[model samples]
Target: MFSRAIAFIAAIGIVLTVNKPVISQNHSEHHSVPSPSETSAERESSRLTESHVNEGLTKLHQKNYSGAIESFGKAVEIQPSHYLAFTYRADIHRLLKNYQAAIDDYTKAIEFNPAHSYLRNSRGVSYAALGDYQNAIEDYTQAISIYPEEGAGYRHRGAAYYQLGENEKAMADLNSAISRNQKDAEAYTIRGEIYTNLKNPDLAIADYQQAAKLFLTQSNREGYTKAINLAKSLQQQSIVPDSK
Candidate 1:
């Protein structure tokens, strides 16, 4: 059960940050003003792009994943530099288990918005899903470098390290993640597994207890149940005599 829970978390626990659309304003004060015709054309393009984006979002909310991808693709066609459209398409691709396609789209998004840490993190998740932990680590590292204050990057990188059998590195990264966000139930859960692997059942149980509490607070019944059960199982094992 514990192993299955770990796999479940690994498969679905990757966080994707959605950015709201920002209204574009004229920046003539800082840069040379465009010709009236150019400005008008730009406005038309922006309007079309926004229309497609809205349509895509509506389709996404309806669970019409393929329709949403089509709409987002149109937005990209209308505005090749529309990173958000690429991101939306990539998210759908990832949901469909098309990891390589998701990675490609995410790479395009990152190329247009290099400073967006969440984009890198999302790309890393796709890479990890494809079992390319090395590439995943690189993307996660870039995300951490872009926004070291965010715990998601550290948490993800820690999980990748854990998969690579680098428990010490995983522990360090998970510690960093929990330090930044004590309410991070996922981090606690992963850390608990690390402790269990290291033969520290006491610490593992403590972490699981904390994780269970956090998960319950977050209304994640599945996570809470898994954590609490793991803690109880460990407790029972600890009380039993060694077979030797």
Candidate 2:
């Protein structure tokens, strides 16, 4: 989820992040979710808007990030309240390292679709990247309150807590992340790092081992190797502490 949050819209860069899953707007529900279908026409106008979106996606796939943004911009301009275009454009901005712009577009997207937790989390991740952990924590807390079943929110909040050196709170949040999703490899990995910071190599190694196994199960070989290597390195450090 961090990768989803942090990884560019298409794996374009490396940094801290959360997952950015597409927000699912429930059309069948009676709730106040805004539907673009309501605003857009079925024949000519809808075709044009959809064409722009498709072109944007194609540009994104071609690694034409700026062009993709422009196309999404056109889509939104056609339907000023197009939620998907705003979200996609925001993602491109985030991937392009335009954090503030991404935040702005994410905000607009949220305006059009308020109940989507991933959108909130995506904005929080950008806020965190900009060194605004308090705001990020607020966003994460709100998302978690809205969707308690989601582990990504907990993982993000835990990481933000760790950033503020609130190790106890971070551990509690990390535990929640694991409880919500037993296969949360990043939570285990991060908790292991926290245990390392606490100077408890035994617990650290255990967590790292779990993360490695989970990553392997998730077919994330790179993550598995990194966690395993970290565990091995920690074991060596445990065997030979630094001279005081």
Best by lDDT: 1
Which residue runs of candidate 1 sit more than 4 Å off their true CA positions? Answer: 1-39
TM-score of each: 0.85, 0.81
Give per-residue CA lDDT, model 1, range 84-197, as digits (tens): 679778877888899999999999999898987778888999999999999999999998998888888899999999999999999999999988888889899999999999
* lDDT, candidates in the order shown: 0.81, 0.80
TM-score of 1: 0.85
Where does candidate 2 clash, by residue pair?
A: 1-18, 1-19, 2-17, 4-18, 4-19, 4-20, 5-18, 5-19, 6-17, 6-18
For TM-score, the strongest prediction is: 1
Q: What lDDT tens digits, residue by residue, belong to model 2 across residues 1-244?
A: 2122222343554223343366233212322344566653544565677678768767776779889899989888887778878887887787777899989998999899887777878888889989999999998998887788888999999999999999999999999999988888999999999999999999999999999999999788999999999999998877796799
Candidate 1: residue pairs that collide: none
* Regions of candidate 2 where Cα sits further than 4 Å from its true position: 1-20, 23-43, 241-244
* Full-model lDDT, candidate 1: 0.81
